[model samples]
Target: MKGDYNFFSDKKDDPLDAVCPKLSYQQRLWGFLICSGIGWFLEFCAFISFFQGNGKEFAIIFSIGNLVAIMSTLFLSGPKDQCKKMADKSRLISTIIFFSTLIVTLVLAFATDLTFLTLLMTLVQFCAYVWYVLSFIPFGQRMLKKFFSSCCEFE
Candidate 1:
């Protein structure tokens, strides 16, 4: 060969190649707070309804919260968004919490007559699910970093 030539030669640059900036601290804080608050409120509503002798309403509201939590998580980890990154620790803990809450939810679901307990467990599970999704966000990553740093410093 008179000259070395490669097929993958590209001198042009595309704007689409640029990555989106990570979320700001404020954005993450607001996201975490809003998501957590809405989840908590939804579950609290279900808990109250259960004690009000409105089992039907309780079930409906609880299901709604559960769907919201799961769907939101799916949205966060959605394949379309290639920028989100979750720390290893965050992913591990979230997975553990998710499974643990899932087991408790299932148990409580079958226990019957323990409406209050069931609602409480469901709430916990929803919160865990929310955290799982939040972990992939920049704010969540920062929060986790700070938490681990504090823990290490205390030791």
Candidate 2:
């Protein structure tokens, strides 16, 4: 629709892409906070659905929440730019793992009646999500590896 925010629209034409910015800092901050909050709530509800034996609901809601939460980062960088960053070398592997697991989790939840597989993939998806986040921090993944290795070292 004409009024809807087409987040993927080109920068110069869109006016929200920082090239010729439209949204003010406060508006962007509010948008981020609100979307993140809604995402968190949906994730929480997904947990309830899981325990209530609604596997498909759990998968859909949880995935939606994850997507919404990630989408909130668009407020920090324009949508296309954010997508580029996700596909960049530093974040690529984790992004692939995260998205693939998300798909696997949903498929297992809906296609097969395999609770174990769906749950396992969902857990894996969450871990991949965290890993993807770590990619954004300088040395975060390296530090985590070092920490784990040091903890495992036994003389």
Candidate 3:
């Protein structure tokens, strides 16, 4: 392939060709696995910190973990495509909310002494991440909507 052929971009060849031309499949997989493992470990630490009542620690560590986990996607798809997909119209709102809440969560944790508010923002950030991730799955957003409506809808 001359690498000019992005004609079938949605197919596998495009990213493999363009993104990390030097990285092999095994390298990408290994990178993802290592990063994901570290991310999960950090999240576990955040969980422990939450239970220990260290709101500051929990907020910072949890945010880092979430970011690292999201970063793992870069190993699977190149950043350009990943970003384009993230900002796709179908998921744009969720992506905006996720990023906005991420910054807000960090700010609440660092700029104020309000531990409880920091905790609340962290929870909101987590929810935003969930909403953002769901956009990647077909019908994920629709299924969640139906489920929420079922619970909230009144006769």
- lDDT for each residue of candidate 2 in 1-155, tens digit (9 for 90 to 100): 23545344443434435442456667778888998999899999999999998877888789889888888888866665777899998899898999999888888877898877787788888888888888999998899889899999999
Clash pairs for candidate 1: none
Error of 2 at 141 (Å): 1.3
The C-alpha local distance difference test score for the whole of candidate 3 amounts to 0.83
Mind giving the per-residue lDDT tens digits that candidate 1 earns over 24-59? Answer: 445544554566567667868988988888754665
Cα distance off (Å), candidate 1, residue 65: 2.9
Give the TM-score ranking, best first: 3, 2, 1
By lDDT, the better pick of 2 and 3 is 3
Best by lDDT: 3
Query: Each model's TM-score?
Result: 0.42, 0.81, 0.84
TM accuracy, model 1? 0.42
lDDT by residue (tens digit), candidate 3, 1-155: 54343332445455434555446668878878998889889999999999998998899999999889888877766666778888889999998998888888898888999899999989999999988888998999889999999999888
The total number of steric clashes, by the backbone 3 Å criterion, in model 2 comes to 0
TM-score of 2: 0.81
Whole-model alpha-carbon lDDT for candidate 1:
0.57
Kindly indicate the candidate among 1 and 2 with the higher lDDT. Answer: 2
